[model samples]
Target: MTPHNELRLLPWSGPDGKPCFLSTDDTGGPLSRLADTTETAQLNVGQEILGHAMDVLADEEVETEELRLLARDLATALRDTLRVAVSRGHRLPALDPSTPIEANEGLRLSAAAFG
Candidate 1:
């Protein structure tokens, strides 16, 4: 893995049993829990699209102008996600909609909810 600015180089076995490369971010949160079990970090949205771009650029696949546009779109998605996280709040429980929704039964609930 080679870290380049916000992108990190990732290597993996291709379908043909050869090594392939992808660009990723080491700092981003996991895209899924499954990836945590591998040497690869869970890919964020930007990294997922960028990986496709890497495949195309590697010349083992078709080349198209659309890939450049896709990379840009992924970059924007990552930037927006981070911006929203920063602007709205940082606590994890608040961000997750599945977290228990408790009523203001008493001061304890309020304290736990805010914390």
Candidate 2:
């Protein structure tokens, strides 16, 4: 069970595009499962947006409106992805200060690759 101060990480954002945290002890309850399912769907949509953007970019004569629409879609996907990532990060235990620095080298490398 989670402590009162520790809110459960939800997998989805609220209607206003804010991260949603649950203050429930039942982490494995029906509502939690539903949130998990919804999160999966949102992630899938993000993936699809990436694919669609790729297709749009590959076109020889993309219109300005098309590019604008793609940009909006990408923004939405990025927001959702960030929310999901933050929620998951909150659920993880803090890294020990004495742990080997090499443990997080992969994350740094990945971030650099994206950067």
Q: For every model shown, what is its TM-score relative to the native structure?
A: 0.28, 0.73
Which run of 10 residues does model 1 get worst, by summed lDDT? 31-40
Candidate with top TM-score is: 2
Which parts of model 1 have CA positions greater than 4 angstroms off? 1-44, 60-64, 84-89, 92-115
What Cα-based lDDT does every candidate model obtain? 0.43, 0.74
Error of model 2, residue 72, in angstroms: 0.7
Best by lDDT: 2
lDDT of 2 at 60: 84
Give a tens-digit lDDT track for model 1, residues 24-81: 4443445312223232232355467667667667775554666667667777666544
lDDT of model 1 at position 97: 48
